[model samples]
Target: MGWLAAGDQYEVALIEGRVAARATSGRAAGRQLKSLPKALRDHPEVDRLRRFAEWLDRHAAACVAQTDLWMVSSLPVPTGLLARVWPDEAWQSALRDLAVVGDDPDEVGFLRDATEAGELRVVNLDGETVRLSPATVTLPHPVLLPDLDDLREFAAELGVVQKVEQIHRATWRKPADLADNATTVTEFSGGTYDSRFALAARATSLGYRVTGGYATCRVRDTGAIVEASVWIGEPYWDDEVTTGGLSWQDLDGRTLPLREVGPVAWSEGMRMAAALHAGRRVEEGKDT
Candidate 1:
């Protein structure tokens, strides 16, 4: 952003997401000040820069959240859409170094760049840079990535840190030996919370929706949408409560059998349950 005239002797601009001031006609002319000068702290230009910085922060967070949603759903994002947003630093930060699959699912690579002409440059597992111009690409969830461990290792070697969690996201696979009629898992049950509000707060903080008496997460699994939910407590209850079993439900609200639960749904449900249980209060010096 261009520096704005803050006062006769000072100019202000945003530097590294912060308001910075510089002298215009003194010994420190043309040099950025270590801190915003006292006179410019409340200056109109300085205030504007600070507000701009706040907006940038919110924009960056929103970009990361959107990117995470795409990856979790394993949605096919159009190449043109990526190219259009590639110029934006906030979008770029969220997308850079993410694992991407083009037309051929076997050919997985770490996204490096998106060209204006809808082409993408990526570094594959074989350590080769390749360009792909497929109409669409999928940022598959980690659970669906066949070479997830290899990708994690390669990312570490490349010093890649994704702003949106992808390669390192925790995943679970449904077991094939589950009983046909079983509908819920009790592994995360018995988590005690001091109050219903505290439990609901934890659910929301972990990005899960607390509705009615359950903490819920929806996932697209095997062409069908499923909701994985764990019973928290009544929304209006003020007394202490304990978490209940985790289960999956179909669109019609029928509880799905454990054996019928898809991998993504099972994993996401368990993830939410585990996160909520982890926040439960533990007795001092007792096994958690």
Candidate 2:
């Protein structure tokens, strides 16, 4: 009780800061609204955005606390829309750890090919947690170290990797009923890409004006058209697929083998998005 009383002034100051968080919320909502095209305006998605804006307004200060917990805590996000919709540090970090340990859900699903997976058995070193695993599984450098920078990177890597994993698995889990309007297939490209999605991500990272579209490329002049699909949503627009397996003769000729890329994890997001996308009623507070 005495300790609580001692920190009463600091608590008041924190609550005062929360009351003044309107400016922060306004700026974020402004940035989000400006990015939408005129077509998305008045759409149901827009309503979701507006509600998101309002939630930001209500939780701006709470978000600050959540952010602190996310960054400072060694906890994992596990699964929650609160993180995807309004990502906290913990959610981001979990994904980062996921990517670092090679369980990257986005870039590629777990190469479930192996029964024995190498794990980074983290051990506490002094006051921090350090990953304990063979350095051979990774470079003998920062990954095993206990450092804030490493954790920050780990979280970023996970979010991106999960997106990668999301593509191969998206449609099968649940997808664009409009999947009929758009066809997905593996196509060919001539350009040398270390990683198509990674390459595209770097370009967008530097603030380049870019849009996802099919480009004809060649592997030694084979002249294959590579069609890469991208999705635009909150946070970042992402590349969904890049295929160099088909012929341009197909997209133009309108007859081709098709396969959609996505992750098995999206079954939850899909069931929700599909219900919404398909204009089916979803009861509030319902959990799948």
Candidate 3:
């Protein structure tokens, strides 16, 4: 609640119940404290900041998880449900920039704004702004949506870009009978990363598309195309966290049987998973 001198060179204070610190004097004076030792960073305010940060990280993960559920299940989410959570920054951040389809399903566009009073705004594929009051909305993954390339062009014309990578997110098609014929290409555990962004970047460099917290790519073999995806953890948080299992799917969004998968598909999927697995870090570090 008050400014205190932890040492002659540093001044720290409780700012709104969170620890804030600055150099007393020098090139770093008045700047935030960083790279301090564990004992020194354990101040009450600092601890509060840390806790809030963790909460934010989890919130982002939850958003991706929820969106993924919607896409995977092909379920229609009630507009009222989106309205209720729209006011929350975490939810809004997650849902923003996604392509939403109303009752017609043909009328698809990018979600631009949602008022606290429940008014929804979107820029349609025709590059015109439209208002809507549909009972529900569905966020379809690009692979599931037709004219995706045209939609991307429309978004570009409208100067709208996705913040959450929905349009370009990696998606795998589900096989017709996933449960009976499903197989995992490879499963790697103990993979570590400083943050999700680094993992995403690594995947992107390898020509994999990131979406819904997973790195994905499509493989064509023997006149059949299958999707391969590997789950990377949430984007925030500093410490190392293990990556999720890498799997393959058919066109219908169902998991494929490993034995049914072509050698090329299997090899590529494992290549992606293994490359990502190798990039994991052993300790906490910077996001960039």
* Best model per TM-score: 1
lDDT of 3 by residue, 202-288 (tens): 899866888877888776654577888888876564555567787888899988766677655665677678778878774547421
Q: In angstroms, how far off is 227's CA in candidate 1? A: 1.4
Instruction: Please identify which of the two predictions, 2 or 3, would achieve the higher TM-score against the true structure.
Output: 3
Q: Mind sharing the TM-score for model 3?
A: 0.53
Sorting all predicted structures by TM-score, with the top scorer first, yields 1, 3, 2
For each predicted model, how many residue pairs clash, with residues at least 3 apart or on different chains? 0, 28, 10
| Pairs that clash in candidate 3 | 19-45, 173-250, 173-253, 174-252, 174-253, 174-254, 175-254, 183-258, 192-280, 192-281
Which candidate wins on lDDT? Answer: 1
The lDDT per prediction is: 0.91, 0.29, 0.71
What's the C-alpha lDDT at position 253 in model 2?
Answer: 43
lDDT of 1 by residue, 231-280 (tens): 99888899999999999999999999998888778888888999999999
| Poorest 10 consecutive residues by lDDT, candidate 2 | 1-10
Off by over 4 Å in 1: none
Candidate 1 vs. true structure, TM-score: 0.95
Which ranges of candidate 2 are over 4 A from the true structure?
A: 1-12, 20-258, 264-272, 277-288
Tell me the lDDT of model 2 at 95. 32
What is the overall TM-score of model 2 with all chains considered together?
Answer: 0.21
lDDT of 2 at 222: 16
- Candidate 3 residues lying further than 4 Å off, grouped into runs, are 1-40, 171-288
TM-score of each: 0.95, 0.21, 0.53
